[model samples]
Target: MSAEAYSKAYIARCHKTLKEWGAPLDGWFVFNVYDCLEEANELFTCELCGCTQVRIVHVMHNHHYFERISVGCICAGIMEGDILAAKERERLVKNRAKRRKNFLKKTWEETRYGVSLLWYRGKRLRIFRLGNGRFKVCYNNTSTECHKGKPITDFLTAVHAAFDLIDPVVEIWHA
Candidate 1:
């Protein structure tokens, strides 16, 4: 269906269930969206249909009425302008999280804090602390003969920065 048709149907449903702020659908907007696996602690009920355990919750607001409501995807599908965009965003979030978790479990776990060579995947990571107190880092190499380009000082910060190249949100810890 066209956007206008969805908007019209959404407004009609709002008229029955949703409270309009200033001029009904004029100022209605979706603020946030979340795709739950099992279920989030917050048991959100659809303001439009009064359904429970909504898999996807669309946090919406009516600027005219100055009211906020959380509704399920079924209700949001009729009102939300682009459900595809929301789904795309959800996919990206999951992908990033999965990459980060795997990097931590595999790469981070395999990292061996050696006296001279910090090894991961049986290859020495191109990270070395120099005598001048600056740590040298090399980017994209297969062997020990790597470039000394990025310089870092702190150990934890350097570790975080190195893995951030793979996944920015990847966590670093001492233990």
Candidate 2:
């Protein structure tokens, strides 16, 4: 559907849902938003509009009714009375996903000592295999096990950890 049509439909559906719940249409606040690509095999449906195939979910709360609802980006904007903010948040999420994918696809040069090296954001990222058949990632002069001290079982995971380490703001959504 076109953006205009979708917005109109979302606004109607959201208004109906809120009215039925005895809630105000414009008082909803977006508390949290996240991409559910890694959590579920099937896409989520918007709670307000019943729209299917929603990947990025927005959690909204209404202070008056003390109700929370999960909806898609457009519906979220309608509920919150700020479509631009919703679109901007979605844009950031998409950009983060793209950056993470590109970070994994980057080629890491292997050193003679078996350390894999890649330069990111003017900093050196290194991944090396440990004697215990696990991996460790080094970035910004710091080296540690990935996944919050858990043993990294593969090179790909170590590389992902390096990306997360370098870009702390990007949430890791495993493909």
Candidate 3:
């Protein structure tokens, strides 16, 4: 289906789900699938407030076919999530970013010192030290250099913590 047409259908589905779930206007519907991905629908509860109240819902279009069916991040829904106090959410986001930075810094240190290693940007043990007690890190298509000194054993934990920041900010400002 065309992106716009699929988007409209997704919106309709979101409204239906909102009604069925007894969600208020303050709540938002998150459609977890692309119109083309014929899969069982799964519902996600807001991790922030745990209120099932959607402040903003976003319908992402994942147009891949060969991949083991992935749920489009709220594809059939309005930008909906929990109602977070603006300042509070922002603070949380900042904290999450801080955690991510720290995590990356530690990852660099570990990889550099040969104490531990991990893969990022398609390369295992990838890091560059700047000689000023700092390390450069790369992942996906993004790169950052960090100064904090820590040993990283769980980069995914840092990423998940960072998502806690990102999701709320998007709900507050973009959605």
lDDT of 1: 0.51
* 50-104 per-residue lDDT for model 1 (tens digits): 6666656676665566567677654554444555654554455456545544544
Expressed as tens digits, the lDDT of each residue in 120-169 for candidate 3 is: 43454434444555444444455444322343234443333323222223
Q: What is the Cα-based lDDT of residue 12 in candidate 2?
A: 84
TM-score of 2: 0.79
Residue 155 lDDT in candidate 2: 89
What would the TM-scores of all predictions be? 0.43, 0.79, 0.25
| Top lDDT model | 2
Clashes of 1: 3
What's model 3's overall lDDT? 0.37
How high is the CA lDDT of each candidate model? 0.51, 0.79, 0.37
What's the CA error at residue 81 for candidate 3, in Å? 10
Q: Select the stronger candidate by lDDT from 2 and 3.
A: 2
Ranking of candidates on TM-score, top first: 2, 1, 3
Cα RMSD of all models vs. native, in order, equals 10.8, 4.3, 14.5
lDDT of 3 at 94: 47
| Candidate 3: stretches off by over 4 Å | 1-6, 25-175
Of 2 and 3, the candidate ranking higher by TM-score: 2
